[model samples]
Structures are given as C-alpha cells and as structure tokens.
Target: MKTYYDVQKFFRRFGIITYIGNREAEIELSLIELQSLKQEGVISDEDYYQCLGVLSYEKEMAIEKRSGKQ
Candidate 1:
C-alpha cells in the first residue's frame, strides 16, 4: 500500500469499494473499513498499518489541498 490506488486495491480484495467524489470522505471511509477489518481479525497488523499510513498521508494531502483552495 504505497499510494491511494493501492489502498483501493487493498479494499477491493475484501469486496469493498469506496468512492463518493470527495477524497477526504473516501479516506475516512477506508479508515473505518480498515478498523472494522482489524477488529474482526480479518487483516494482519502489517497490512493494517501500511494501509493506515497511506490513508493518513492521503488524508493529509487532501486536507492541505482543500485548505489551499480557501
């Protein structure tokens, strides 16, 4: 999970697809799904952390981008 595309592919493996036009919202939903999978023991710690880091980075970038427009 190095990029946002990787994150989407990760979730797709679990039959999960997320996208609602907003980058921040998409990341937030992905985080929620990731947490649920973690709690259910559906994913390993390594994958979870890797995806989490990517999502966090993407979220931060989205935030910065949105703020820059204001």
Candidate 2:
C-alpha cells in the first residue's frame, strides 16, 4: 500500500479492524501483519518491501508528531 490508509483498507478487506487506543501500536501491528503476509507468500517481495517502507515511514512520522516536530 502507498499509505497507512491504504494498509488499513487492505486489512479491512480481510475484516481486520485493529485498534488498541494507540496509533503507534496499531501501526506496529500493521507492520507485523505485513511481515507475516510476506512470510506466508501472500504478497510479492516488491509489495512486501513497499508496504513495509510505508509503515516505517508512518511510524517515523508518528514519532515525530508525538515529539512535536511537525
């Protein structure tokens, strides 16, 4: 996916709507889910890496937001 919203949409396709009241935690879980899907061969290497990159970017942005950087 290109963004966290896209990732959320992807998870929604499987009826997964996870939220533990923590944005960072949710993104982390999404990253884990993406990794799992990659390991299971459900997605290609390119797709896996692309999604991970998006998640990582989101995580970094979240951290920065929490730190009042942007």
Candidate 3:
C-alpha cells in the first residue's frame, strides 16, 4: 500500500473495517489490523511502518484539533 487509504482498502478486501466514527478509535482499530496483517505476512515491514506513521500523524492531528476546540 502506498498510503493509509490504500492500506485501509487492502484490509477492506478481507471484510475488515476499522472506521467507526471516533478518530482515535478508528486509528486504534486500524493499527490492530495492520499488526495482524504484518504478522500474517500479508504486508511488508516497510508498508506496515509507513501506514502506522500515517495513522499516528492523523491521530496526533485529531487530538490537537479536539483539544483546540475545547
């Protein structure tokens, strides 16, 4: 996968959907799925780390956004 969206799509192929409204929850679920895929050898370490980085950035941005809104 080239991006987080691509990684999410890859998971979707296996009926794995990590999106459930909350940004933090979604990111957590996505991370779990990414780890599972990595352990299963379905995705390379590079791809897994890349996707994790993206998700982590997104999570940080989300937290910042929410804190700013408060």
Candidate 4:
C-alpha cells in the first residue's frame, strides 16, 4: 500500500482490522499479519513489498518519535 490508510484498507479487505490503541503496537501487529499474507502468497509481491517498506518506515518513525529521536 502507498499509505497507512491503504494498509488498513488492504487488511480490511481480508477482514483483518487492527488497532491496539498504540501506533507502534498497531503497526507491529499489522506487520505480522502482512508477513503471514506474504508467506501464504495471498498478496502480490509488489503490494507486499510496498506495504512492508511503508510500514517499516512508519514503525521506525514511530519508535524514533517515542524515543525523542525525531
């Protein structure tokens, strides 16, 4: 997905909705779900990798923000 909203939509399409009341935790959960979909070959490589990159960046940014690094 190109954005976090798109990520949510992607998961929603598969009936997977994630929200743990924390951005980092939510992203962590999303990453796991996405990885599983990847392993199962349910998601296209392009979409999987794209979403992975965006989510990775997002998770990193969230961690950095929480640690006052950004």
Report how far off residue 63 is in candidate 3 (Å): 0.9
TM-score of each: 0.95, 0.83, 0.77, 0.92
- The residue pairs found clashing in candidate 2 are none
How does each model score on lDDT? 0.93, 0.84, 0.81, 0.92
1-70: candidate 3 lDDT, tens digit per residue: 4556786787787789887988788888898888888899987788778888888877787788889963
lDDT by residue (1-70, candidate 4, tens digit) is: 6788889998998999998899999999999999999999899999898989889989999999999997
Tens-place lDDT digits, model 2, residues 1-70: 6888887887777677768889999999988888778778887788778778888999999999999999
lDDT of 1: 0.93
Least lDDT summed over 10 consecutive residues: which range in candidate 2?
Answer: 10-19
Regions of model 1 farther than 4 Å from truth:
none
**Which of the two, 3 or 4, has more lDDT?**
4
Q: After superposition, which runs of candidate 3 have C-alpha atoms over 4 Å from their true positions?
A: 1-4
Candidate 3 has its poorest 10 consecutive residues by lDDT at 1-10
Which candidate gets the maximum TM-score versus the true structure? 1
Candidate 2 regions with alpha-carbon error over 4 angstroms? none
TM-score of 1: 0.95
**Candidate number achieving the greatest lDDT relative to the actual structure:** 1
